[model samples]
Target: MKRLLLFPVVCLLLQFSYAQSRDEAAVTQAVENLRKAMVDGDKAALEKVSDDKLSYGHSNGNLEDKATFVGNIVSGKSDFVKIDLSGQTITIVGNTAIVRHVLDAETNDGGKPGTVHLRVLLVWAKEGGQWKLLARQAVKEPVK
Candidate 1:
């Protein structure tokens, strides 16, 4: 009886771990893609990473829709460079995952390199079997 119970417990643990791994990979990749896109200034990449009607709340309290965000990058209004994720935590609960990435980044607006220490909350949803960013809210954490 003890062996049987232990076996089921082990199997259940493996199943849960596997499920979590899948979700983790999907959302982590999405955020990584976004970072790369921002650094490369590739507006086209947003087509896959972001939803059509996405809401973006910036650290500076600016709100921008999908079109505006992409347009700004493509039109030379915004530029990001040397983007590096310092400590990132991604968690998935059902179909929703909140990704927090604290990084050092360089922006054209004369911000400290990665010292921006942005605490970004990225919301991703599974749509048609692929995960895409539905919303993002961020706050600039003070440098410690």
Candidate 2:
């Protein structure tokens, strides 16, 4: 009797284990679009993904507000390239979500070509039924 009750519960949980939402495919699509936007440096997409009061922390320890962060990309200052990436984990809880993504990026680094393997933690909050990024922090790990 105990095993019979446990089996259905286990199966039900497995069905929704992917993420906090039933529509995980939409979240994946949203993340992919954001990556493309960051790589191509489309200011519009950047703005769409972020909240008005966004806090951005760079891998180099520089911090910028949402406006400054978007402006830098629009002005051609910090550019993204070679954005090879892997599994992105997104967790939605109530009205907030956190996305963890691992990316291998090649950058001009303001005239010096550099490559970095980093994980980005992006905090998102659902405001007016739309997910907006509240904060983003990127940390680089030395790859062997």
Candidate 3:
């Protein structure tokens, strides 16, 4: 009787782990998509991947809503030359995913060239059968 109970519990744990792995992969892809959209300045992709109620916080303490965030990228106010994300980890809870990563990027905002290194935290939510960025915050990291 003890052995049978343990078997079922182990099987259930394995199944849950597998499901979690799949969710992690999906969230990772979503993060990559967001990076690509930023680098490519693709407004449509950005809008699609981000929720309308998004809260995008910059390292400089500036916060933007969905429309402003999209508008900045679309209007050349925010342009990413190259984005390199590393040390990424994603955790899922119910329909929400929390992602943390180190972001290093070359940027050209309004024709001013610069580079940024940041530690970023992103919150993504499942909506309409897809993952959308619900909120994001970044803190500037000193370059070594």
Q: Rate the local accuracy (lDDT) of all candidates.
A: 0.82, 0.79, 0.96
Looking at model 1, how many pairs of residues clash? 2
Which is the leading candidate under TM-score? 3
Angstrom error of the Cα, residue 13, model 2: value is 8.4
Q: Candidate 1: lDDT of 38? A: 77
The TM-score between candidate 1 and the true structure equals: 0.85
A best-first ranking of the candidates according to their lDDT comes to 3, 1, 2
lDDT string, candidate 1, 4-104, tens digits = 88998999999999999988997888888988887787878976788888898988899999998888766657778667886788888888888888766
Best by lDDT: 3
What are the TM-scores, per candidate, against the unseen true structure? 0.85, 0.78, 0.95
Q: How much does each candidate deviate from the true structure in C-alpha RMSD?
A: 2.8, 3.6, 1.3
Model 3, 1-144: lDDT tens per residue? Answer: 999899999999999999899889999999999999999989999999999999999999999999999999988899999999999999999899999999999999999999999999999999876999999999988757
Better of 1 and 2 by lDDT: 1
Candidate 3 Cα misplacement greater than 4 A, ranges: 142-144
What is candidate 2's TM-score against the reference?
0.78
